[model samples]
Target: MTTRTLPMTEPATGLPDRITIYEVGPRDGLQNEKSVVPVEVKAEFVRRLVDAGLQTIELTSFVPAAWVPQLGDAEELLDLLGPVAAGQARPVLVPNERGLDRALDKGVKAIAVFGSATETFARKNLNRSVAESLAMFEPVVRGALDAGAWVRGYVSMCFGDPWEGPVPVEQVVDVCARLMDLGCDQLSIGDTIGVGTPGHVSRLLEALEGAGIGADQVGVHFHDTYGQALSNTMTALAHGVRVVDASTGGLGGCPYAKSATGNLATEDLVWALDGLGIEHGADLDALVETSVWMAQQLGRPSPSRVVKALAGA
Candidate 1:
């Protein structure tokens, strides 16, 4: 793969010129939580996320209710989004054609497809081999494209897996290449177990570049288990990647990777970006407040280090 170390981002600058915060509070953030967030609350939370100026929100997953009862309200939640705001994009997660059909039935204009980078993960997590899962999604992607929907491909455990040691850079890039070739508008690479360091992140992105995926077509999904999400984010930004995945209050942990935490907090990402002059329109105070409200609704304190620090509770 084509890999290169990128120049560092100057700490003095504020947030970047424009940043797209893909809010996963509903799907990725909620799927792994022990307590169930009421359907109405989830819907209101989604509306709140949009009201908070988040332009792209990953709403919910169309996975079977039997698999993820927490997201059983996907259809109801999608209905509550009302309509796409002037410039916002609402994307939902789909596991296959059945899931995509459910999402499309709700008229979702953008959708995300989930896959794994490792064969073991693919088999254990999705009940299929890596190639088998990708092949299954072929018709789904083609159908979504034909329906004029923007499709995003997700490669989970891009860096490491709980069952596996350090994931090879080549494996990550290869899966990414397959997804990108399937007419996916974007590919989100996830650090499922949060075991990556800034240097590892740099190397991975460099590999994607070598694999012919442009920085703009790539998105980063990080968990804060190692407390290095922000630093690795810096590495991602330096390589010209534009999108990031964060959840409100750091809502859910990685289900497969035992003891793993949830995604990086939106507040932390926005804080770091704000300090970099990156110009993300996310309201840190409001986002933190949203986290506080959701945490209270969930009858717990937020897991986000940034949210906890800001709440001063």
Candidate 2:
């Protein structure tokens, strides 16, 4: 059966005319899986995403197998992807210098470094204080930039932390500025625990702008734990953010933050953007089909509302 079409466009004012949906289903979405996905399946998944018109898909991370065994086939997966990985903005997450080296050796042209907005998370996730983590990332970011590759810096737990509740906006801004100073081309602010509200999202974006980090160079990554991911994304778009990070079937959460849930689903995001009359070059039917297939592979129904509704699952 053919999938359904999206809602008719109703353009929203004060939002960017076009939006870039940075697809993370292949990397962030599958990272926390209990069982590893076959590299061949991962290659097909990426190929399907590219065919679905997602121009920027994060392929995988170069972290050690002991860290995230789910993505241990990173090199093999890339080798399988071959030219498919070359045609689009395929960014990989690199935890440190060694991760960066592996990605570079694989001819990766885009890389992202993950950072924490709270000290507790920094220690828990990176085993280092915030200062120490940033220091370590400095050279990694510089090296990627020198190699003429694009670098993205992710600031996690931007709104609230599991250990340290209600993170101050200024604290997030400081970390964001530091990441940018380290030569990151873009920064993706993450509500890692999904405890953020629209007001909180606005305050954080405004504070970042005040700190000289404009929405043009920023992206928003939200989780659906609190059922606020879509609303928070709308708030960011209203503030002029053009890049959004989403997983294909609402497929990922932070392993470090137990409270975190699945990410903002790409099908859900596309549905909202279509309703808002924004230009995001994704094929809704294609995305829903991909999510449905992936959900079958994972032995569960897709959590994406749009995918379920459209696929009639």
Candidate 3:
């Protein structure tokens, strides 16, 4: 006997008809692992994500091995994946001009630069002041754009910083604007410590709009430390944002921010989108299976509630 199931679609009035899930499992998800995940396993993870119908997958970062040893095989992994076909957006994280040079040499067409909204996080994560980090990114973003690669700017700690406590909406807006000015095609606002509520999310979006940065040009990346990731995501969707950053099986955390937890799980987000009647092109069953396999690789069960429930079912 076989059982069939489908979520009841109740479309929300103010949300976008379809939103792009910017899948970050390969890069952001595995970056904090203590043990090195082999290049072949990482390649298969990317393949599984593609098979699960994720349109925009962040493949890996080009930071030095000393910085992020988990993704040291960026070039080898890209080689395994071969040429990115037309219509597929596979973005790699480039920390500076040197990383950008390496990615461009590999014929990378999409790249992202990670930034911070607060001075403390900037110093801790990048070992530079916020201004200095932006200065470093200016040339990198320019070089990527000049090379015809699509660039995304990621502003971490948009909601709250462990060292700084609550981050002001105005501060986040300012950093986002600076990143936009750096020629980034899009900006991903990150709730690095998972401390944002729905109200905070709304106010931040409003402030960003006041600064001339509309939701159309932004995506939301939420961690689940406080279990508000889905609620915060709903708030963003209602505010006209159409892109969301999520990890498979809730796999990642910020290494610099020890208080931070796993990212907003892709499975949970997809389930929420399914119920909301929002169009996110992902196969729920395939995603669940992929997360289960990945969890096995990491020697633990998935932290995603949706993945657990579905996998058990």
State each candidate's clash count: 15, 0, 0
RMSD of model 3 against the true structure: 1.0
1-313: candidate 3 lDDT, tens digit per residue: 8674567888878888899999998998999898999999999999999999998999999999998899899999999999987788999999999999999999999999999999999999899999999999999999999999999999999999998898888888899998899889999999999999999999999999999889999999999998999999999999999999999999899878988889999999999999888889899999999999999898989999998787872
Residue 89, model 2: Cα distance from true site in angstroms: 0.4
The TM-score that candidate 1 achieves is 0.94
Give the local distance difference test score of model 1: 0.84
User: Which pairs of residues collide in candidate 3?
Assistant: none
lDDT score for residue 255 of model 2: 80
Task: List model 1 lDDT by residue over 181-238, tens digit each.
Answer: 9999999999888888989998989888888998899889998888888788888887
The number of clashing residue pairs in model 2 is: 0
**Reference-based lDDT, each prediction:** 0.84, 0.93, 0.93
lDDT of 2: 0.93
Please identify which of the two predictions, 1 or 3, would achieve the higher TM-score against the true structure: 3
Q: How high a TM-score does candidate 3 get?
A: 0.98
